[model samples]
Target: MQIRDLPYADPGVADARSGPRFLLWLGRNQLGGQLKALAWGLLHFCGVAGLPLGVGRAVQAVVDRSGSALALAGALIILCGVAITLGDTMLHRTAVTNWITAAARVQQLLARKAAELGAALTRRVAAGEVVAVSTGDVEKIGWFVEALSRFAAAAITVVLVCVGLVLYVPELGVVVAVGVPVLALAVLPLLPRATRRADVQREKAGRATELASDTVAGLRVLRGIGGEELFLGRYRQASQEVRRAAVRSARMWALISAVQVLLPGLLLITVVWYGAGLAQDGRIEVGELVTVFSAVTLLMYPLRHFEEIAMAYSFSRPSAKRAARVLALRRTTEPSGVEYGRPSGDLYDPATGVLAPSGRFTAVVCGDPDAAGLLAERLGGHPAADPDGAASVLLGGVPLDELALDEARAAVLVQDKDPVLLSGTLQELLDVPSSGKVSAEDALKAAQCGDVLDALAQASVDTDGDGDGDPMRTRITERGRSLSGGQRQRLALARSLVTDPEVLVLDEPTSAVDSHTEARIAAGVKELRAGRTTVVFASSPLLLDRADRVVFVHDGDVAAVGVHRELLHGNAEYRAVVTRETEEEQLDGITAIGELAVLEEIEESA
Candidate 1:
């Protein structure tokens, strides 16, 4: 089956079952491929089991008659060789197919779940855990899945070979039958301990991965603050801990391996010693004795599979649990009876007593940045305010939580100050998914991205690849690293404009740009979003001036709601804050001018 045809849809089932149950579920789902693999595996094992019997028969035939029986035995031996080679080849091919297909299915399922959850996924599970599960856990799961059929085939072959020996040579068969189980079961007692150690190793690895991801993501900030050394030291400590855990895990596995080898060797010795006595009593022929010994030797190969299966399970169980935990995270609770149709008008957050009436440009001006952030979250249904309480965000009187996920998401779009830029080209970056039908050119014009387009054009001219004339087709590095901070911010704003949701909630959108650029953006935004509901959370006077209405948020509540001019004129506290900010800017300007004057004087004196 194709990987695309695998069951990737989120099943919405909690993974609260035991490891064995989960494995069983996987087997049951991939039953077709699994059964085929098992059949081939059985055929392969039967061929292997037939080899010793053929050899023993050939030896006995040579001892009896010299011509015809020898020829028949020779033919049997040649057929056994051909069968074994063919069976081994088919077995390996089928087993590998099963492994790859199972891994692909799990990966598809995880990807679908990630899409379903969106931003809510990280809120539920750590980024590191998700990374681990997708990369490491999926592979281990496939290993165990593929190993299952081989394990079954090996076991069945051992049992059947032992039974056949009992029928053909009863004295040696009893010894072989009894010895195999002891070897397989001896490792059982070590499994629980090994599994526990494996769990610890996985946990440590996850923690180390999380620390490394965080450190790398924040490396620039840490370096700027001269804390790189400290973070590096911490990472070194974490790496050491992982090393220690790994050592412990390795030690357990080594001990299990040693026991696996020692027990099988002991079983072989016991069988040989007991069989020799039966042979002396003339109860078994020399050829029969050789066949029993060869069968035991062949049985050793399958017994090793028992060890391998045990080890694979021990390693894979924790990974499966982690994947299960990630899949179990619910994206949203079931919607109530409050049917959410198209929003009528306006967005209101009853919690902060803030409302942005529909089809109007609203600006939220908060004195405290933290309060502004919280207000933005509330407005966009991010924190998802309590339903029973009076602190709910509503779109056209429908509670945000009560609305279906698609409806709620389509109704409002929250653009943060530092927006994430996924790896793609400039055109793909601007073409984010949204219900509102807005063109890329229109959004670009609204964001005043002439300079951005120019930069892309310059890059395209310098680039030595085909189709380089299209500036929009230029590949952007992950998180738009090729772009400057202000450029990235503006590009993000343009993308949001392209979405053009009913309510566009932006938090400090132009905080990274120059005043001239900020002014142009403010004017362009006002003109582009003329008849839509756009809320800008900023204390910038340039943006505040263009808003149709500005709400003064103080101490987590709306202090006043009016035009910028009205607020500036009336509210003394608001006036004091704005006046202080303007004074600081003027003071900074004067200091810069003073420095320039001193430099001019020095040049004149020289």
Candidate 2:
């Protein structure tokens, strides 16, 4: 039952089974890698059923003149060519190691259901259907679990070559045991119309891969609103409705491959027209009617593996029911096993009169950037509110959904103001999840980032200089797109102040820098986060004047709290919402005559 013990199994009895009973509960939880790839696919289908019993014993040793029957038909055609090349190389190395261990156990059960729905798996799935169920529904559930060991070694080599042609020649084994079960149950009534056209071509290829991953994650806000040819003509009409549902699921798999080649060429012309009238009525003998017409032409090669295990279980049962509805999303409140000990120091909320208290540097100041993104998802346990109601939030005396997702992500760390700068080195994006606990020159000197490490050491010595390096060790593109939005918000607030997280939070984190690099990042984040538990959010009056506490909020609650000049001399709606001072007095009355001709050229050049 490995694959890390199937994520603690009983996700409520895997939500009442189905998708072929969750592939028979993943072949009864990988029954020893499907019984060692079904015993090397029944010793590679008994070496392809000894190649039609060595071509009907080399055509019954050339109609038996019997002089050691052509050296026993050249030693049964060199032992049927060394048992068809050792059963086609152990049936393609045990069916490609049962399709790479059933696609590495459905990609380790969709990465343990995306680490048990962390960040609530993109609010319940559709990040292009979890990137098309982690890549084409994990290769169509490892091509129907390695085509169930070559469909149980092609149904035991079509019942041992129709019981050895019904004991040599019973009317050509009753026309090959009644025409190999009518050409393997004639594509089982066209497999429920080719599995409902391959589940409408896998739901129009997961809605054309969720409209091309939402038009490439909103191609830079749809090309800054030109709406990039209206989202590239709605992703070219969802890729022509996924190319007309993949040409109606390839016209029902080309009419099930033209009835698997016209029912095995009409059962090899009814076993050579009734075994040529029982070999001219001698009651079968021309070497047992050429060994019952070469065992009905080797029962059409295991009835074409019963039409390829009915087209790999009609395209892996809708890609294992879209990976079992993304491992049945959960989290509505569970982690109560305690252990969120350290926080005891301030970040209360109770709907609005926010608190923030702990080690200091609080800020908030909202004015509705969606109520500061729902108060940074209720101060980062990411969603589970209700700490005794009234807008609820709290941290000191614990409650961010009773902690535990690794102790509420190791005591809070939000960051987010378009943070996500993933793909690689600026020292591996400030060595995320704390590898080398924050170095890169103390997170680029608390993120003032010495001119982004001298412009990545002059673009890595103009793209390659033999100099032994330290171009901040190169690589950063992705969300860092080679730098700037104030160097990706001061390298994501210097990788969250190199995870000194006891409770960092942030949100605005110098919303795109400037005001003298947001007053040297509010005094280098109050001197490299002095006594921890930060918060910040920001309406940037230079990070709310280095906040010891600010609050403000509004319609969603906490209309005012303290310091930023005591809420600009006692909160007149927090000084008309953080001194947009009447839009800077209507932009100083439309630049008052170009500010008095730039004050008469600074008093006639002084």
Off-target runs (Cα >4 Å) in candidate 2 are 2-33, 36-108, 111-113, 116-126, 131-139, 150-152, 155-204, 208-243, 259-263, 281-306, 313-358, 364-408, 415-501, 504-532, 538-563, 566-606
Model 1 TM-score, all chains together: 0.88
Candidate 1 per-residue lDDT over residues 422-454, each given as its tens digit: 988888887778655678888887787888888
RMSD (CA, Å), each prediction: 5.6, 21.1
Q: Which tens-of-lDDT digit does each residue in 1-606 have in candidate 2? A: 344444444433343145777776776665666676666666666665665555566566667655577577667767767766776676677666656666776777777667655554765677888889888877887788777877787787778777877876666787787778877887788789878887887888788888889789878888887888987787788788778877987888889889878877877777777777777877776666666666666656666777777778888887788778777665556667866576567778666667777888888877777568657766776653323354335788677666667777777777777777877668777766753454657766767878888887778777777744576677777777877888888878888888777777878877777666676667777777778778888776667766788878888777677777656655556665666556565444433334334434543542
Clash count, predicted structure 2: 3
How many steric overlaps are in each model, in order? Answer: 0, 3
- Model 2 scores worst on lDDT over the 10 consecutive residues at 7-16
